[model samples]
Target: MATLEELRKQLDTIDDQIVHLYEERMRVCEAVGEYKVQSGKKVYDQTREKAKLADVASKVSGEFNKKGVQELYEQLMSMSRKLQYRQLVQAGALGRLPFIEVDSLEKETARVVFQGTEGAYGQAAMKHYFGENCNCFHVHTFRDAMEAIEDGAADYAVLPIENSSAGSVVEMYDLLEEFENYIVGETIIPITHTLSGLPGAKLTDLKKIYSKGIALMQASHFLDEHADWQKISVVNTAVAAKKVLEENDPTQAAVCSAYAAQVYGLEVLADHINNEKDNYTRFIIVTNQKIFLKKATKISICFELPHESGSLYRILSHFIYNDLNMSRIESRPMEGKSWEYRFFVDFEGNLANPAVKNAIRGLREEARNLKILGNY
Candidate 1:
């Protein structure tokens, strides 16, 4: 056998040749991209890729080598497609995104809507985003708030999307998919829960507690101490305080914000009762118009992948190839499809960025029903 040094030199020579051939292949692929661009052809050709993979596998030796070559070619083909997408963008053939870029939201004359009654967290978020004196109204349900924007009854709607200690507001995610309204902005508010009741009521007099479901969960540690107290879920925490005040029953108390208790004319029996002291909730401002602010730095999108192994990985690779940073991802069950899910992803990129366009274009070709939920 040859010495170890000689064997290493042989492998290095082969590697150098491989790199040279790879570069030659990429040059050919670039020419193909130019040809397709002029011919008005799409970048992704699934049939051609499948045939090429089969041919590459046939040229390899063992089963493992065949699989390895297939995987390698898959990545190479993916890179070629991405290069073509970038070329399309350079040629201005990628087309304009549907969302219009605006200097800023029309906060002065815009009518905003929120879910639940006054003094609710949604109201707080609305005030923080649109301004305290902005023209706004309350709706009974989240769906109603979405409809208010969809039907043009309101220019925008404020809704809670996620909470820090608890998790995502699931209903809000569903409503986002169901409606055409797009998120324009977001705000984070610190959540401080309090146990409040009638003016003279005491903690010992509490028999039942009322608050939003997620609010009750957030205050689980405090509620666990009062195991005998029945926890009731309502539409909103502020509404719960209003309920406690209207009932006039010392046995009923509410888990709500201190401001809400004061708004509903109730007295706080215990303050800062939430499990997490530094809890915060993120709220999104949505509008019917397909527009995004010029300074927006985040984009949210949803897509369904084919129920096949590596499908999701392939879809996500576009983000990696484009060097886009994905901030968050959540999956929801696709309605009427058992075990199939729709993925929602939040990434750090504006609508006008070429990388964003390339990644989105690749995802649109590979994934099903890819929707740009918002760019904010």
Candidate 2:
């Protein structure tokens, strides 16, 4: 065997040759892009790329090298496709997107809808986003809000999408697929749960607690202290507070926001009771129209991947090659497809950006049923 320094020198020399070959390969890819641009052909030639992967894998010696070479060629081909997409964009060959771009979202006069009753966190998020005095109504469930927007009963809907501590609101992701609503914006609100009861009720007076199921879970630490208290789940935290006030039961209290307690005429017996002090929930502003603002900087998209080895990795390479920053990803079971999933990804890039266009172009070709949920 060669000494360590001798092996390092040989590896460096091979790497230098690889670098030169990479540049030459990219130059050839540019020519291919030009030909496709003039011929009106798609950048992703699936048939050709599949053959190339198989050919490269066969040329390698062992099983490990075969898999490694295939993976390497997959990335190279993805980079070539992205380069082709960029060339198309530069030549004005990239077609218009399905979504319409608007200068701004209608805020002042637009009617808005949110789930839950007065003093709900959803209500607070809606108010903060659309302005405090914005015209808005309340519904009983998140699904109802989606329906309201779909039926044109409301111009917009505000619903929670995720929580920092508890993770994603899975129902929201499902609703996005079921409804035609598009997310135009989002807001984050700090969630500080309080244990409240009718005026003058003390913690020791409490025999039971009522709140949204998630709220009760979040305040588990505080509730664990009084394990004997019967914890009941309700539709909304505000609804729980309303029920406590309506019942006028001294032994009953609610886990809700301080605003909710105040709105329902309840005394906040305990404040900041949630296990996670810095807990926050992200809410999305959804509208019926498929429109995004001109300066929107983030996009939400969903796609189902084929059931094949390295499929997910190959699809994600488009984002990596284009230098797109993916902020979040969530997988939901695909309906009627057992053991398969559709992925929802949130990434940072405007629709008008060329790099974004390049990535989406490649992703759409490779991903099954790809949908751009919104760019905002």
Candidate 3:
């Protein structure tokens, strides 16, 4: 064995080399990342990474599987990206958060877009996140918001992901998987459902009611109390309120936000009509670039597992194994498949961590579809 002095010198030599190499590597990676981000290229480059792995493996000394080295390279690459992102952020290359500057976002005026009309929760969320002074637009469908952003019609889209009353929205989860965008921010709003109908209408006279899916689910108890009443499931609660007012359907009522009733000229039979008092819905703000980080509490991601009995379990186990808490998970049928599914998960950590990257790296080996929805 080498003497202690020799060992100490070698250790120092290795440490110095590591530091020097890391600095050198960062000098290049940081520049490239800045350019990639400015050019709107994706942060992670698998092909480039693969080519790097091949090049590095051809030169490394040990007989270990090149996968280990590739992992190391990936970790380094991720670290470099984070470093680069930090640099760009500090340089104001990436837009600021906690109040994005109107000019820096490259818009002459502030613009916000959400699914649904003026009285919808999406509109409330638009106001909540963007403030009342900002210009905002509404779309009839969730896909419309995505399409608008993709087609350069809007700068951002806000969509709901989960509700405290209902466990999870499967369609939204699947929509997240299908869409390509960055989750810029999150807004949690306390939902208060209003029972509104035509003026001078009695509760006993109500034979039908209209509401959005979540509001309907929330007000299910009230519906159950009136078993004889017909329920109408509309695309938006605001639409229901608007219809109730315009049609003046004496027999039909609507359960929606009070704002919807006010906007749609519907009379409120009762305010705060939800079965649960503490109802809240969490919405995700999606955009073309990473936007918010200061107030982020959750991160959403998706993974596709191989068709094996324990593949899903193995992948999920990593969350627990890493001591990372998962707030929610759902399996949706994959597109273009007869019996295949992709898993969408909301976890409680940022993707900027080494631990998170390592977990994703491990997961990527077993997954056919792996995507980081957004850090926020």
Candidate 4:
């Protein structure tokens, strides 16, 4: 009903108004961020957003629809929450209010290394944790990621530790022991493994499937469901999708994120093909820097206990004695120790505190091979 010129002009006008609204919103958001900082309240508030959405929805009527208004306001509220979170996080220690000087970022920005290909979860984690302004080089193996950091070829390395459906990455834990680095932060990403194949490929035509190691493990139920298809495991989930593109084989498909399907130019044969729908992977951001977390956040440490009776109990007693809660504890068999085991633990409290420091000392006296993984 309208000419292209008229449509373009209307869009330009709307864009200008949108930009003005965004600027105004940010002005208020900045003040809210300051208020939150002063009050020591969290930046994100779901209840506040729900109330806002309901208030906005109540005002709309007629053709606009109440549900539509609620949905639109909910999205806007989500953006507001994110903006506030970023503001608080940026204001806390990095941008302004210099609690800790991270001036070494530029000095140490030689190179960044990560595990897997461009669209892998590790790449996303690296970008999410270290900011997305720079290019990151990816390695094929987790060991190579550690080796790069160890050999000074890379300033930082990203590795995946655990997944929701499949649980802990035993290989990554061992690699952490073999190669040491400080975990600067931790991130959890929701996994959405998509089954994709070459263009025009149909589900019945699929003979073989490709997926990353973690995805393969997560989607083991898929293998069981489709017992006829041969499985090929790759280094990255997105790489598997990309391999389908490169190979141009209609008979084979790759399991990866639905987002990767579009990224790699593959068509999705199945979405959320993981064994469980709500699969998520938790990755620790390992860096050489000794970064600190917020008050409520916990720090991780790796240690080992001898094969004596109550050795684990004696080490845990130190945590109990100090009234420190252990968030997580994992054990793996130590190399060359037939019955002995290594313990990886995560506990609340900063290691900078005297009590936590003494607790580590007590743990050191008890643990056979105790390593402070990171302060946060």
User: Quick one: best TM-score, which candidate?
Assistant: 1
If candidate 1 were superposed on the true structure by all CA atoms, what would the RMSD be? 1.3
Report the Cα lDDT for candidate 1. 0.92
- C-alpha lDDT of all candidate models, in order: 0.92, 0.92, 0.75, 0.73
- The clash tally of candidate 2 reads 0
Count of steric clashes across candidates, in order: 0, 0, 0, 1
- Model 3: ten consecutive residues of lowest lDDT: 95-104
Model 1 worst lDDT run, 10 consecutive residues: 85-94
In the predicted model 3, the residue pairs found to clash are: none
Per-residue alpha-carbon lDDT of candidate 4 for residues 1-376, written as tens digits (9 for 90 to 100):
9999999999999999998998898788778878876787765464776688778878878656888887666556545544554454445412222123232344235477888786787777776777776557988888888888777778777788888788888887887777767766677888888888987999888898988776887788866787899998876788898889999999999988777788788888877777788878888766555545544257678887657654576568667766788988888887787977788888988755545654664565446667777765
lDDT of 2: 0.92
Predicted candidate 3 versus true structure: per-residue lDDT over 1-376, tens digit per residue: 9999999999999999999998898889878867865786655565887698789887777758566786677568656655554454455444322223121243337567899887998899878877776777888888888777766778878889888878676777776767777776788999999899888888889998998877898988867888988888998899899888878778889998988888877778878878999999998878765454644556677988767555676577557655679987888887788688888888887555544554564455446778777766
Writing each residue's lDDT as its tens digit, candidate 2 over 339-365 gives: 899999999998988898888878887
Model 3 ranges with Cα > 4 A deviation:
1-109, 290-297, 320-322
- Higher-TM-score candidate among 1 and 4? 1
Model 1 CA lDDT for position 152: 90
Q: Where does candidate 1 stray beyond 4 Å?
A: 1-6
Ranking by TM-score: 1, 2, 4, 3
